[model samples]
Target: MEIMHAVDFRTQLTSIMETLAKTAVVEIGKLFEENSSFLKLEITRCTRENESLQQKCRLLESELQAARKTAGKINRTEASLSHGSTGCICVDICTPTRLDTGNCKLYITNTLHACFPDTAHRPAIDNVFGKDWCLNLWRHEESNAAPNEDTNLSSSGVTVEPVNLLEEEPDMIMIKEEAFEKCSSDKTEEDQNKRLRGAIQKQVKEILPELDLKKLQNVVNHLVYVVGVEKIDDLTFVEVTDLKDFLEPIQCRKLVKTLKQKDFFQESNEQDETPTEITLTPLSSIESIPEQPFFPYCPANSEWLQRFQIPWDRMPPALTQATATGQRARPGARREFVRIVVAAMQAICPNPNLAACREVARWIVSTYPLTFGDITEEGEQLGNGYSCLQRQLKTRVEHVNRDIMEHRIRRPRKGLATKRGADEESYVGKKFRNCKADSYGCVNWQPSSIPEGETPNSLEMKRKVAAEIFQSAGPRAVELTNVDDLMQQTYVYQRHMINSCPPPSISEIELSWPFLFTERGLCRHFKTLTGIDIKSRFGETLNAKAKRILNYFNSQRLRWNEEIQSLLSEIDSDSDGTDNNKTAISAILLMMKYFKEKETSIFISADATSTKMSIEKEMTLPATPRLIMLGNSLLTSSKWFISIEGRVSHSIDSQLDFAAALAVFFGCFYVFNIEYEESAIATLELIQRFFVRINTEGTKCTSKSGTSRKTGSAVQRKSQNFHPRVATFMQRLSEFEWKTSN
Candidate 1:
């Protein structure tokens, strides 16, 4: 009975499934039919629309043909009139009418006294435009030609009164208004352009009187496009094309080159209302400039001139042309000029004082205003116009002096004993002498003694105690403990250790002074030594200048090396904490490039693929400060370690913000009493003197050589010193700041 009941249930289920499948098939078929019908309707509608568009296009083509025929006939009639007495009269004597075909026609018949063909077509024109139209047209042309006369005569000898077109045909006035406005605007624009050209020419002539007038005028023609343009690249394509049309390609190139010059567009302080009267100084006056003989201060030019076998009285033709005609010399020529001038100064004295340089510069400018004069836009001269010349002279003098000092060449005066060398004044040494910890100058560089009641022996004991606490720590509560006082007491002893001739290795120092490696301990130590809040100052400055610094790097993207370019690309692609690390690393790398230093000099990275044995070998190397990035992708890692004394001394303590890491890296130079790395001295010095503003001077960074001679003391070694590139960078950075501020 159970088997019979099961069979019946299975049969019922089979019948139900077949019925549902049939119903679904019907529904799907209905849906497919509806979709097909909708698609067919859309296709039919589109076909109809396409057919309508084709018909419209054909109609437009036919109307265009008709308009062309009408235009051709009108042009022929106008050409006949132009060859006759009405040639000079530019008048629109046709009334425009729109035809059913959507083309506009000039209906000459609607215009009274409109021009027509000669007497052969006179009857036809009279029938079309009414009688005497040709006669009236001739009279109209004669009247317009002689506007001062009240009447005009036709071929038939009838006197005709001049008619005012606007009064007689008010409707024509509307049609002519647009043409009148267009003509007047073109005339005004032409006049404006002329005035702009004249103004630019006058300014250029006043400021640079020695410029060739023909070339100056050509440049001036293009200056009209730059009336309100700030940058040369900002000129529009049309404006640039127009400029090219006015001058040859080479002349246009020269114009752009001149505009890019730093001194070319200096703002003038002179009042526009009171234009200064310029007096032309004759060549005779310049030729008569009294020669200022060099004495104890500066060397005489005769010695070097004789050495080079150059005629003393006669200057090089290149120099003469540059000075006399104000022609810009080639780079090679200018460099040769500097070399010759430097040789002259170095003959009697390898190092000339500032006064001597200024005196020489003044003589040059005074003798040749056309070449050396630094004139403002208002034609006012800057103090002697010789500061740039003075700077170049000083730089060349120093470069020669460095070579002299490096080779230990002596230039002894006849009557005087050998003077101590001024080369001993290292910018770093100077800062160390009057060292302050912050912008508020204070003399805390050398702490004479430890805190009261704390003897040197007791501080040593406390340092050991702190070390024990650090070593045994499981997240040591540094802030909650009294380790701060212990750290403070041991600071004097720590300085002594750091300043030791052969500074202790990272392990030795850490073992003795473990607290110094911690964030709090490092901050306190740097503050006590230099009076700067490293963490706070680093964060503040980085936040303020990060975008600008990145922008500066971005601007030089094409100029960087592959490694640096790769790093910059990564920075642009990522904006996480890793980006800051890459930014800081790239900045250091770029600075190294600017100073022509090697990357391995200050930085060594460990790749993910790098063998443990290789890193272990790097760890066993000599004691020197270095930024260490662990892992591949070149400093993209979150952890940046400072390796001083062949070991990782401290990890960057910014929770991945590398600005603080950078600050500490710089502070290591001061803290360790380590002279800048020999290979990266200038790069490091610029960071110290300019960005850090530790031991800054009013003078520019002028040193050209990269070698640093060790003085008597290791800590007192001279830096690689100046880089003109750094000076230029500073200048541009300041300008960038000024632009951003405004």
Candidate 2:
């Protein structure tokens, strides 16, 4: 009975399975039919939508044709009215000064013009605009003023009869209204651009002072595309295609890149990029510029003039102008031209000696076709106002040759020193300044009991100070703690660095535990001192592991000179063409970065020809930014300039010469035909001499030459074939002092 029941159950299950399979097949078939119908409907909808778009496009085309016709008519009217005048004209509306309200009024003038061929005028009927901003078809209709009438802007506005749109034909008025609206918008854009240019230029001078004007030549296409695509309203700059324009593009990019890096701007979103109202923020407030000279006070122009000797007078005729269509500085205008150029330089510099004159002249001459345009024919060489200007510049530059050849006239300088070699005597040994006690975290700086006026400003009483500092470290020295709290304290400590940072006081707790800080600067400080990265994990938790490694070097308490040298040598070895060298190189760079950022003040000798000047400066403050030039030849061949008789801060604290370091670092990396060790040896030799000079002379070895027998210093040493001119140039750089003022 059990076997029979089992067989029956099996049969029943099989039948049920078969029945369910059949039912599912029918249901799936129905679903397929429904899905096909839905797809058909979607196709129909899309087809209809596409047709509608096509129709709209056709309608817009017809409207565009009509607008173009209207524009053609207005163009004819304008052409007839302005038949005898230049294509462009300006009619300024001056504000009354008699009332003497100091506030300057906006919309001081109204200009009427048509520009940009592709963009037609659009109606702004709903958006009423002022006439001053309107873009109307302006013409001296049937019988008004003659073409030559003087329409100088005055306190009284231009006299004109206003035409009412209501009285004119609808079609004609519509076209005029569109034109007027466009003109208004363009005028506003122009004004915004003017202000933007001023702001941008100011930023360039501040951030990228070493940038040469030539770098700006290739930025037009990139800038225009960015502005047009992004519709960047704040910088709605127009592109100029003139062959004579010398715009500053590299400097512009430098400013923008820096601002972005500093978080002043965020990267533009690729998605959801719609044109929105732009808000431009002014750059961060920089330190006030104290009255100072234009050039570093090296006071050795005879060497400078000879070394930086340029061929200013060899005004090579434009190579493109292959046909020697002789163009000379016009005979009668030559004297006047020279006079104007000299006068302009003298007025601008307050002392147009040959050296000063040369510096300004090189910049002027770089203006290319703008300053010296092509002269195609005989009359082209005639002294027009533009030609006169060019001639004047050339004449001033020519003075360099005369001075160098004759050496008869003494180079005139400010405070003309009656005694010879006064520059050397006046500036020598006078630049030792006391480092402020509160300023901590200085490279190799130890706590000193003596003041600025006292000897031993820089002492290596490290073991004693280390005990005090480590004792204060207390809990921080024991173990890892809250990183956030430590970072805040470190931020406050950095602010105590008076010259580079703000004058902020660090509390006792913060001062006691500075090494516990895990900020960018503290990380750099630890890495520079010891080869270990204390804050590898960017956030809190100052690497407890890395801290152990710092014990070795920190315990020894090496002398300041010994420490700096050991660190540099280690960096040099690690940074030599290896994948793992980035950290080491970065450590070296951080040590010099702050000093490079500080303002460097220079006093240009009143006499351009003679190098006689003094630089009064504080070692903590800088005059100009020093750029690390790793151009096409960072590792192979880099140049070091040599000039004599210049000044640098007499403070020993300013010993890390950024320029010399670059020469050493890149000189090692540079791929020369010589053996790697040979290249490194030469670079190391240069660095050694730099250190020797720094120790003997208070100056960074800039003013006194290694060869200057005037002091108890070693003879100027040379590695291989270091150029004499380059040596001289480097010598002159050591004598400048820093501003002791706020």
TM-score of 2: 0.29
Residue 62 displacement (Å), model 1:
99
Q: Candidate 1: where are CA atoms >4 Å away?
A: 1-355, 358-390, 393-443, 474-477, 500-503, 556-578, 608-614, 617-622, 696-723, 736-742
Encode model 1's per-residue lDDT on 1-742: one tens digit a residue.
9999999999999999999999899989966654453355357546645644565566667768977986786566445544645432333422111122111113333332344434533212222122254346545554555653333223334434443332344333223345569768766655544444455566555544423444455445334322333222222222334455433232333344443344444432132332222222222111111213422223463233223322223456777666544433334454577678767766655666655765666566545544554432222233225555676777777776775664345355653332324444344355343322221111244455568887777887887788777777722445645788777767778877765645566677777787777666777787887656777776655544545666776876887678667767766676564455566656666667555667777777676444435565655544767766666655465556677766666665436566766676767766655555556666765565444544322222222344432332234333211334554565455445545656
lDDT of each: 0.53, 0.32
C-alpha-based local distance difference test score of model 1:
0.53
* RMSD of candidates 1 onward, in order: 27.9, 27.4
**TM-score on alpha carbons, each prediction:** 0.41, 0.29
- Number of the top-ranking candidate, with lDDT as the measure: 1
* Sliding window of 10 residues with minimal summed lDDT for model 2: 692-701
